[model samples]
Target: MEIELSLPEPDPAEQDREVIETLINDSKYTSFAAKYLREHKSEIDQLIKMKTKFGNTWKDVVKTGLRVPNSKVGFYATDADCYDVFGDPLKYVVHSHNMRDADPNAIPQRVVGGDQLSLQVSDACKERIISARCRFARNLTNYVFPTSISPKDRVAAEAELKAALDKLTGDLAGTYTKMGDLSQEEQDKMVENHQLFHNKDEFLVKGDFYDDWPNGRGQFHNNDGTVMVWVGEEDHIRCMSLEKGSDISSCYNKATKMLEHLDKHVGLAHHKDFGWLTSCPTNVGTGMRASVHISLPRIKANMPISELKDICKKNNLDIRGTGGENTGFAGVVFDVSNRRRFDVALSRCHY
Candidate 1:
């Protein structure tokens, strides 16, 4: 006798079945993302096939469209203000019409970017390495995800950010160049600078983000390349500051100064409860990351990669190869960084 089996009912509201199925049918989902969703189908409230302005959304695409993975990834599809639109969890509901509302009493800003990131990585440290970096993602209030960000929106936003950069004098003074406007030679040089990583984002594979080829993407950096802001790289803006050693305060100051200036003049995405808002949930809170690169010759020589990675994982640390993730490690140097971005304070990241 044949037996009938019952499958759990799917959540109608979790995801738009039509779009999810369509992307799957079209082979737009990454093997990793598709496989991941399929394996953990239960934890997912919904499988959203979202649209970004430039690239496709990946959670560790939030890496986050909720850049997913990295210990805790901010799933963009579910957490996006438009997708789920969760308002202040306390004053509002999980998926409200608006999530940008900020509380009056909440701190206007988190850390003073430049204050805490001033220390330099010492030469005498056990690992002989110390560097600090703070990166942030910002979204505009008017646009949907990057998928739907209109050309007009991209141009206007770029102009606004560039204008702010122009206003700054001294180290912050610089020019904003659009990807579409650069000459082939300049573009090649930019790529060879070793500053910008090749966009190997999985979302690009899934979403065809390069369809127009540099429609609105651009970069803003100081002459020394110390202060750089990637225009339309991941989110609308990837504000970053790099420094040698562990002077996190200096790094934060450089990046935050730009963000604050823009926030005051143009505005940024933020919520009272969630702090900063982005396509990735992991990036939502303070929208800040502090990282250090340590050359652990002793540790690398003594420990296996698997074992060493495991130890870092247990302690809320993230590691990347010396040459970054895709490329193999460069000798013994490794990119070690904090694991959490939400709720956790900036100071704890250093600890």
Candidate 2:
């Protein structure tokens, strides 16, 4: 049975085949992967086209479309992963997590524990992992979405949140002040606390968030700097708290308590079925984004961006830059956060 039959030479074009093709065509796929291939046919086509024409971003595909509820398939790839894979001279991966939910129908919601894990950033920063921050947002009942709201309404909503800060005076122990008033050192201090957001989110900009400027915008942090509240950032009220180490118990306690106190005092807008409603449909549920900042010196020195990203995705985490959303790296600081928000109980997110 050791017969040697002459075979045709391999085609040069097929020699370096795309990984996507292997994923789609391989019969050795497990039931999960096989079902994945069948369900994401259109996305697969897009990936193949990218591979054949421009370049393929396996990290983006996996991170945005992996194991989680309401997986964001067709997620636009960011150049950040490309930079990470190429080992950008200026930055390295960091780990952070976020818990968020949105109530709406435009974006498809996934079943319990569906595709939503991307792990490159978290793995790179595992050894250097520092701490986790948990946060959430709530919009007011009267005001329309920030995108559609007039300048007058924006100010009104901002004023409302500013008033709510007082309700937290004793329990949370923080002062409310404008960002511009904070000096350079103070601003830098806030940055480390994950309490400072200098610019507006891009989605907000396209929706005309700058119409009223920072007139009503302000930040609040507790004495020890573990708690924070953003008035007039992207949402009407965004409460956040970040701890110094990966102590989920402590971090979650501060975050939930902050929300609990604020909700009791100033009532977060909510719908019966949808839970918390945010400006972005993506953040309608728990509206919590829990993340940790980590440093990855060795991974920065050893791997290519693509392979590094691949490792992270395999591990079920996501890597976003310090400045956030494609503003380039922040040296070695990265935000690694939980990607699943729907299907799972909000309480379970801490686990």
Candidate 3:
């Protein structure tokens, strides 16, 4: 005797409803993605099938947080997804950034050319600061972000930035080195000097950022290495300036010059409600993270790390390890930076 097997057809309607209900009621999961899904139950089918130009569906936006289990705020595929898919959810989420009562639809515009020198660390505090660094993130206009940028578009974008960087004059003159071209030793040296980015980040890994790895990525730094730009890192552009001591003004000014030059030569992505268009909504406004590596031996000796963290939180500041985020501090030295990326004016930022 012969036997035949039959299988029932899959149902998208049933699948969509299950996805919505599961995420909405998941007590262990708390993120903006789940919040949005619960509030928009009627649009479950539309969201399930919706895809941005960069091929980011609602699934892509929430997968990292849902899978990681401990992720905060989750992640975004592109700037468009924030407004088109997760706007209201983000309004509640960003409130944690001290943006209480702020309209997520009315983020301030990008502010540059401010008097960076206006704010100076007092002489006593300056004595403990090892170095100062000011860095900001930027993405190119008319291009998808790094999270889902096509390999072809990646090369084209790099070419555009390289052309503009090649035109730097005076102290800004520097060389752009392709990541794939660097030897292992050379790569190690760059990492040691903190001039290169690595692919060890779990958040970036889960987001598919390292796909087609190093195919169209590079770094550009000025002759003195004070000014630098990481091309095709987490963001399309990671522009920064660093110098010894607490002369944050120098770092800020150098970075501004580079930013203004890029803005004029190659357009930058800017959102009307969000200052800058970036892959992540957390960096939507300003896309700036100005930081300094400071030594706080006395404070460290007296206070526990948890207490220090609480104090930093109270003052609208963030404290990181010497190696940067997700790492521990080196000896008594720490990386102290502003916590507010949006709503706060750049001109008002003082160390």
Highest lDDT against the true fold, candidate? 3
User: In angstroms, how far off is 306's CA in candidate 3?
Assistant: 1.7
lDDT (CA) for every model shown? 0.58, 0.53, 0.76
Per-candidate TM-score against the hidden true structure: 0.71, 0.58, 0.88
By lDDT rank, best first, the candidates go 3, 1, 2
Q: How far out, in Å, is residue 282 in model 1?
A: 2.4
Q: Which stretches in model 3 have alpha-carbon errors above 4 Å? A: 1-22, 39-46, 53-55, 79-86, 96-99, 103-106, 114-116
Highest TM-score among the candidates is held by which one? 3
- Where model 2 places Cα greater than 4 Å from the true spot, the runs are 1-127, 169-171, 179-194, 314-316, 329-333
Estimate candidate 3's alpha-carbon lDDT, on a 0 to 1 scale: 0.76
lDDT of 3 by residue, 185-216 (tens): 89879888799988778878887778778877
Q: List all candidate RMSDs to the true structure.
A: 9.4, 17.4, 3.3
Model 1 segments more than 4 A misplaced: 1-15, 19-80, 83-123, 197-200
lDDT of 2 at 257: 69
lDDT of 1: 0.58
Candidate 2's TM-score: 0.58
Residue 208's lDDT in candidate 3: 73
On TM-score, the stronger of 1 and 3 is: 3
